[model samples]
Target: MSSKTGLLVITNPKQIGLVLSSVQQKVSKILYIQLLNALSDSASGVHTKIFSSIPKYSKEINGIYTQAARHCKHLDVRVLLSGMKHNLTKIKTQNPIDIVIFDKVFSQTEIDSFLSGKISTLTNNYKILTLNNTSEQNSEELVPEVSSEEEKRTFKHGVIGGTFDRLHIAHKLLLSELALRTDSKVTIGITDENMIQSKVLHELIQDLSTRIENVRNFISDICPDLQYDIVPISDPFGPSIVDPTMDMLIVSRETLRGGHKVNEVRDSKNLPKLYIHSVELIDEPERDPAEEVKISSSTMRMRLLGTLLKPVEINKNIPSKPYVIGLTGGIASGKSGVSHWLQELGGLIIDADKIAHGIYKCGKPCYDLLIQKFGEDIVGKDGEIDRKKLGAIVFKDRNELEKLNNTVWPEMLTEILKIVRNATEDVVVVDAAILLQAEWQHYCHEVWTTLVPKEEAVKRLVERNQLSEEQALLRIQAQPTNSSYAAAANVVFCTLWHKEYTRQQVQRAWNLLRERMCEDVLANCKNC
Candidate 1:
């Protein structure tokens, strides 16, 4: 196998026996089974049980994503199916398909017909590998039975709609069913703009172009002969309301009402009513127990917690050993819990809030400046700045809050930098709630931001801090939104669920960080 680029052809998905039980032993070893089994089982379910029990990657197989990596020391080659989430940067063609491993044996003519000009150009130099061996039996004793659930059906022109973010099993089941049922054309109206605003973690949804590209790619994979019309629609009625040519509307139980609504609108226009086919949304057992049993994009976004989201960046000026991590999040978003974990993992914690507390003491420079800006009355009779009194003066007025931040933030930054310069530990954690607002992310190697949804934050603030729900909500709203933090952060952490789940994410993130650091160190020493 050439790690740089080479195709692996497994002629029949059934040849793999639909097995992935050895998953814990070696992840890479199960790729064949996971990939092939998914293709094998995707055919039978009339949108119901087909993909319900299959590995997550089966749903993940929208395109020819392959790596012919064997005996490659530097590469781990693990495509662990974690919540439909992968590096978003790769959508920019950073990881173009070097190898395409397919289960079907194609005649040379059929293969030539399906290969796009771009794909052919990409692997034009490589040989078309057919790794078929006809030695095995035709008996059921030797090979497991393929699922008859992938039974095919057909419609002339069908339509479906969804956000399709981080496409998972449920999406694949619906799309595969549509592909199976449609004989001539498939029209997909992927939600975008205001239509997707109601989705959980909608900010993290893949862009319109990315979503459309993936849907098109998947349909092409399932049925290359059909003409596909994919569009970004802001409303529920894309072309279905007016398109008289449409024959059917593919929908899940949740979306069955929308299909009826489509027919209602069609009736008003005197257009022929398109038939509505409903499939049960796949109930995936692999998802987080804290999330809905029905697999969803929200769950996928949750799984990205405590993971390095952006690529590793090396500043030529900064030394690599004591990798500084800037951690921040909104109020009651479990930011402190994550910081404590990092401290336990050997990171020297630079508590920015504590620094602010120290600098707000009576004699501190920030204390003097804050009194000059707001009033001497902002300080307590005990000769220190009373946070409640100061908060009363600042929180009510935007200008006063700006003044307060302007006075304290620079002082906090100075103390944080001082500690960073003198730290002796191999890791430094800058725990700043205002890390982004203060522009302090520039000091660290990676910005790890935490989040708990606004509702959770409100509940925590109301119960723990004795604030009213309205007050808690206002406090949360005052801070940067989760999407804003995600945009700037290199890593994201969330403690919305139980602490054990949070631990798993943090542990994974730390392990990966150590590996990355080791690689950086090795690369630097290679020249020596």
Candidate 2:
């Protein structure tokens, strides 16, 4: 079904949870919830308090994810909430809402007045679905549940902390609760630096700026008038432990302990203890049994498998029959391991090292050039260049290595292209170690890179090659950094964990590449 942008209206704020069933069935790209009675006063009112009212309703709908299970996993969780009394025109101006849904409490006349430009800015051209009937009277049946004193209360300032990666529904619910209770300011401490070091698939997490921007955007969408001071935090307790002005702390079940710790630190500082409010963990019933019970950024990052992470630029000069994936990484960074996975997944592995080795043999194109450049003394006793002896000569000098690369790389590239152009496999992996360094990505469809932490790469080299720490360090520093590989890559893999994780990353890349190739075929057919 085509995506529709929808707006849900609830006359009684207490019944917000009652419409999760309806929401689950909605294919809307985004669903905005607007509360009619958020402002108690029509003429004289503090309008910002409506944000707090949303969290009360959010609690009612918290079970929706459990109900939808994995079906609503991709449901846009940046749910926008606003006070409907004054913001109807403002919302319509911001979004092109396709449908308006009302709870059973709204009268037909009330909806009519809303559509006829009395309060709602929605045009009559828009489809309107109402749960209310004209024949039904609300004399006694439609009384909403009375909100508790806590629900009715609002605070001066509220603080919350999280990684906020991918910004899933759980993150949204927590942020909504923070905006709900806090009146003036919402201080968000986004976990980064040393804090993100422990997360699984942490490399895939959006950067600190992106997370902060998304959080700020979500809050601005739901409660635009309120102030949000976003900061990158390295420690467990950031501004919450230090900001004496904060009066409330919003936390999930996971961070409930951290919230109390914030209070404990505040007590020591002689600052007012924040009122700690903890929300339940969101249930993700379809997730792997091994993962946590809640919807998480790490799970979302894992789900990025078999999906396009970056755009691929089609090189028209190159033939598309065997789609080439140029794979590269630093020394001991598991490029070979990833290549093995791709080969098993049906990609024709064109090993650049093998091609270069072939060129170094007798009668091959680079055999004479190797002797001419590095001297005939480098030749082995068996009429071929001795690789170990040549390595000793070139390894001591960067300029000598450059001279050798300049002599051999062109011949190797020509041989690789010849193999690729004639291959029958639907996908081709040009496993080149210096793909980017030699400026070889120009011929391929897209590049896949592998990387590991610099220190981790050194550790792997020491353990696997039985090299000393100093020797491993020298070899690692000789190659390109992770940043360089990532910059040149369309997809990235890390084998720092078990081989199973490496297989998953490679499998995801293979599946997505197949899908992309199929689409390319269809496009070519249409063009014909």
Candidate 3:
């Protein structure tokens, strides 16, 4: 009897050739390959190009498939494109599959789902094989470059603390050093949700359980023999301050001061000061020379957010009904008042900020991506995005704010364009504070910017938002200057003067906008 094997190739384009070759040697007869294409679902809205055709695959995947088809002529191969909702019954019934192969390790739930009904009854008869499809480029072993001279010393117990958001090379290096230096065991204190609120991209920080698991995994992968304890810490001093059993504390050079703070707290409690060992920060040779600062979780989050800078090129063939004007200004610069004045002038105003808020709501396209890029802490109990919580994270840091803009700007632009195309109005004003920063000038026929002096803007923010002078200054400083806005503006409205003066400026700009709109309509009609 010819033995048949059911191969479920959950592999990428690069690994398809190797997977087919390996499977051919194992199975003599029919090879059922269930190619998992994530683009089948609407959830993969970003990847619309991948699932538009039959036997859905990218150009690269198609090339691989063609090559595999030519090479594996002896083997009867049937390719089935699967989405999240997989069909297991039809494949088993038709082929009498004796063994199932998975390119990637499936979760217990997936395993259970795949091996349900009669297949579960005959446990020993059928076999499952998991193939590692990870490329050698990504699987390059990280050999520690740090000097191991001091790592010879052993301690009874050691404690280390950090946010450990995404376990990067630096994090792995730190954990490895701690494990090697410590004798019996090491205790790791991962910063909790409450504690990480002040951090840069705090919303992007992983949950306590995930962070702990990551730390545990790194420790296990590096030094499997080393006993370690991973705990969530609400404060800087988790168990280090209270626990007298810990003999030493390990920390990076940047966090060396924190180690001392722990010692101080221990000293105040009449406990002996723990020996502090500060590990030198590992250099990220992969990063650009300008960005070669200390390897940190903040930098990692920033890098992740940086990937979203360039959005997918969307269809720009919008209707000529609405002549869009991009309006922008600094904080407390009376840009909202300018927008209100424009609205009164019979222009349909589209608030990009409000649109952004709507897009951030639960079940929205940008919502889950935002949660993945930021974190769940930014989401409220009502399942809506907590703008105040989000603002708290981005407003303080310029880079963090830019990261946020990078993530949201593309989605916001796409939405704004969609709205503009469907509108019946002759004129539309897109009021966005980050209009210039987001490079939304492409969508508008003309750009208008409102300006106010730094000092006056600060004073208004303090009075309006009930914030202290320092807090108000921070908010003002975080935004682009009036000069920056003026550079991008076709019409610059100085809002420092009286309401009448601002209105006069708007009235003159409105007259010019009307003339331009007429010209645009005529141009579109001629083309049509």
Candidate 4:
């Protein structure tokens, strides 16, 4: 192939890098490749422009540009945003595109239109090439140890089991293979909490519902016609031991023993053994010369806890409205009263407790997770979470409380940020009992905590819930004190006085907030 300017047309962003690599190998010298795609616009007519930078396009196009830049770092690259009009002659005259490449197979009509002498001035000058269409069997052959023959075998009902925590590429590939091999249905058994405790960073394992939903969505995306059943498994065997109708069991190399155990258990039950289909484990290349051989969930979890997981980025550019405040206090510290006063003063309050309650409803992910972590006793007769039972379990043990916090706090922060982002009010208050403990103060401009004496809180609880003095005191002792709140608070409002006094304190805070808003507006004006 001659060294010439090339124009490549690709539909999928993922194919950009592969096409660029192929073209670079074929050409003798470095090629200047212009990636062309048309954007739909009603106002702009036939406007063809080149992007000078990668970040100036939509996210999808930007991803393609990034991939192309990485693959062709030593070569010249530009992206052309084509308009509706098929002005091939104008495009060729402006760019001197001597070689044209199509990443996808084109129909006869498309080929004729592109090579037509009436429209394209370079119909005779440019060399046109189309990418080779690779079959699924060829694609499977590219994987080192995977055989296309195994994937071609079909089963009536297939069984596969895993914790499926923090679903990654390996899990997706495994599920996709199972879905493709199963003709009627595939049973996916996600390990329950009991089985997941030995896994790395078990606290970060997603809830059962989340794992099931993720697997379902992934299989549907890969093989939409296949039917799948996702269920929680408390043991290694899962449904394979009991479901005599299952014809196949899919397992990784490491879990081949478990597959055999399932067959043994089935033999004892007088059921036929399942046909075991083993898949090779996917391994990552060694980062260091003396590194481990395999990549597993433990390694992924360690990476996530160490460096892969980053703190949520806060946007410094403030929206037009909503100066957010994080309100925190100990139990029975009168935060509700303070939030009420703020609402009366025209501040919109988002109650994190209310949001948590909604999240903990029966059939919700949190509810099921809580039940799995705790016991059936934590659920009431009506099948709802019994707050008293859960409180008793957690409030007495600090470690248990921390476990609960680790599970729920991230979700709470997400919802709180979403509410603040969409709030139309000038001031928005997030009232959460564990606001400082959860580190949600990062989402707010300021932290405001309510404080009341321990004795007063105990007395209020005794009167409010008709509890004995000793019981109320135990509840108060389990929580952080007023001094702890004051340590993390930007503003502390002592709520020991009457309702009017509490309202007055809120009024003063509101006045300060208004002043801050005015100062912000003035600073923005000065900058403008």
Candidate 5:
């Protein structure tokens, strides 16, 4: 009856059926004891469900999550039942949910087998997030979501969830936004990589430990008061359906689209949709009107190789033609420090935030657009936009943020590109946290995430911002809780230690990037 902790638990179909039967029947003997033990050991919280074989178990679990989603606007849940690993090739044509479950944990060897099967299968260009365990302990910790051997299920209170691969500023910004908007505690889900597939993604950077650690660190630093857990679900739809005590599900534009699709599927089954709390898109600062290209991890990578255009004024500071480095970090991970270092070295910092700031300055089109959509209420007395009020409205509610972004992204991208084209600096850093999430990785010469200790980050925010425990907690909540963003980044800078250590890491990375850039330039010269 109290708020429940959202936990992602995995189990084999047969085991799930037995466990459900035992729970429903009020069996208190050996079978029930074993079930309890299993649940407690593997997962904790009311957001627990069985991944089993029996048709009856599936029906019961589905009904529970669906009912939860309907009664509580704060909670969302669903169950992943079908799709074995070998069936991935047929994912597009078969059930989409089933396909995702299959691929979520496929090994390289399994993938090869699928590719070589007689069906003449083609690899989906979409990049699924992946984590490779290096140690035995890690292997056990990073076990794929499916389990033939089950664990006990115990429910905790307070739940929040998100797909936080490359924990960026936008993500943290939203989390911070949420903590401010709600009085309830929070829990989160790191969207299973299987469900997230994009045509453009390629490399899988920073494994699960890094991603989890990033999330742990970010949350510990930003929102220490809120109880947090890494809930594991095969798809966004599942946890929202079954998690009984969950009050709400956090969503962004990308995830919203996925959740909507999930709802459509659920509706076909005559089920209700999950209650979702949508976060608004954090608009990257705009560039000059003449600058039209978008900023992204991909674009940043391309720019670094001289295969893409430079930003406005980015080419002016260096010894030779500008060398653009894609700089990114987890929410509140001190990307500014890295950018400052690059600037101190006489390199140009083609700041995404600054460009975004330029876009929203007085007399810009974004201002007019915001006024039209959200009205003048969000504007301050000085005729300037009120960021806090606007953020509150957008991040707490999904539809509003979508409307805001639809108007801004096109124009924002155009302006950003123009800046890139006119840039002429020797070393320009495209400082964007969501370069990958924005599908901008193709443009980056290389992408990096600011890695920091969650404890240190918490201390820094509390000290630097002069915020109360709760306020600083909210700020950290506003970013990515983990390194899920690593899937999209090429490199990461661990900032848990001292600032000097961070600088040293950056220096080494910059040196390597420099060599790669030189090679790329030479190759281009030959082609010319």
Candidate 6:
């Protein structure tokens, strides 16, 4: 019923457990079987051919095929045993089966044949899935087990491998769903160039460290219990599958057939069979009805090249690319004015003051922390912070100020780092008056500053804020001195009384920043 609700896949064997781990279902309960080719007396099952000459290989192949045929007489195994192996249809008729799964080593010709319908008997009702093609005789297809509810309750341990290029939300979604189904820990083994051929694509996005970091962050954020690593995955079957302690081998449809070849090797070694699990077909986003067309990294590159007129919709759910710019200015300077300009320019402004305000609003953690460190005087009557009172206490005493910085800096940095880590915006501005003081310089690539003479700044404060000249001076003194911030400035603007001139200066700086960002993107692409 329902054409078997669980997935039926034929591909490289290595991805079986990954598929099972993805779906979070058990291997045995879901028809977890491997597709294999055995040398029978030629389709008629008359006499044993090449395999018969080798007693062990002959027995194992015969046994597995015999078992599969007894239950599935309609199944057809392509003649992979012959040196001149051809498509399943190319061979003379042998066994009459409901579905014939053709097995060919990984090869471009074989892939073309299957996809082109040259390999017959395929319909919407029956499908063929495969792994990366290598040589003509290297193709392998492994059938996945149909995952079921009963298998999920029991804890299962599995190991799987992959290249895992550019981690995305789809991967997290697939992993989380699998974890939900089984009480199991999925240990991921990733492949590197040493174990396999390098995957070369035009849009090389991230470096190895960035890719691994993305994978680790995804695992920690979404499925902390799942184990993962960058490891070798060359053997047709992973080393874990042969180990007695390991249970099932997890994989995707693309890797199922590789498992069959592994079985052939295992038969030679007399190793016990390892259960296989395959992941269900994840419909490509291109096929989505809501999305006019699916988008991929390849598609993004096409858009960048202007080969494609419209941008494909890349999955927005995953974290966006990192973008950050450092904005700093001295006491009574026009940093806030510059920050506002950056906002108008469509830059994400992460002001330290805003974070502090949030902490004060979140209440307890910051409130309790302040009171405990500075005594009850810091708390106000209306259940809000009296900024003047708090400022007075800390501004006067260096130890008090240091203590305040110590108390607030950790929490502030934590929040800022989280935002920076997940930034997807084209450009983000880190508006920190005390950026140099707070050690935020290391996090930024460029610094923009606003400069005004101490006397002029003081005059502006008195006139605009209605503060007395002496009060303005005190506020100015409270900020990090101008010389301290100058050391870190990559671009500096002299704030003038004329609003038009100041605006022009800001607009020029923004245009320069945009140019720099585009250059950096282009540089990264070239390196990739």
Best by lDDT: 2
- The global Cα lDDT (0 to 1) of model 3 is 0.66
Better of 1 and 5 by lDDT: 1
Q: State candidate 2's TM-score.
A: 0.78
Q: Candidate 4 deviates by what RMSD?
A: 19.7
Every candidate's lDDT: 0.65, 0.72, 0.66, 0.65, 0.47, 0.50
Question: What TM-score, over all chains together, does every model reach?
Answer: 0.76, 0.78, 0.38, 0.40, 0.39, 0.39
Give the alpha carbon lDDT tens digit for every residue of 386-411 in model 5: 87778668755567867866766666
| Per-residue lDDT of candidate 4, residues 1-528 (tens digit) | 564556665544445667777776544422433233333321122212432221222333434445544455444444433321222222333335576676666665665555452223343577777786522232211113333454446688998999887665456546645654567888999998788865644544667889888777556543455577889999888898999789899888888998899998999999999989776555543322222244456545433321112222344754546788888888788999999988988899999999888877897768888888888999998989998899889877888888778777777777778888888888999999888778777777777887766777888898898878887877777767665676566666756656765676688778766876797789889999
Clashing pairs in 1: 43-150, 44-149, 44-150, 44-151, 45-149, 154-181, 155-181, 306-492
lDDT of 2 by residue, 459-494 (tens): 887899887888777667667877667666788887
Model 5: lDDT to the true structure:
0.47
Q: Candidate 5: worst 10 consecutive residues by lDDT?
A: 28-37
In model 4, which regions exceed 4 Å deviation? 1-321
lDDT of 6 by residue, 194-296 (tens): 5433232222334445656655654443233444443445554556546554455555566688766655666677776556655432333332232213223
**Which of candidates 1 and 6 is the stronger one according to TM-score?**
1
RMSD of each: 8.7, 5.5, 21.2, 19.7, 21.3, 21.7
Task: Write down the worst ten-residue block by lDDT for model 3.
Answer: 41-50
Clash totals, every prediction: 8, 1, 1, 0, 106, 36
Clashing pairs in 4: none
For model 5 the TM-score comes to: 0.39
For residue 233, give model 1's deviation from the true position in Å.
Answer: 1.8
* Stretches > 4 Å off in candidate 5: 1-323, 466-481, 524-528
Which 10 successive residues of model 6 have the least lDDT summed?
A: 78-87
lDDT of 3 at 385: 83
Among the numbered candidates, top TM-score falls to 2
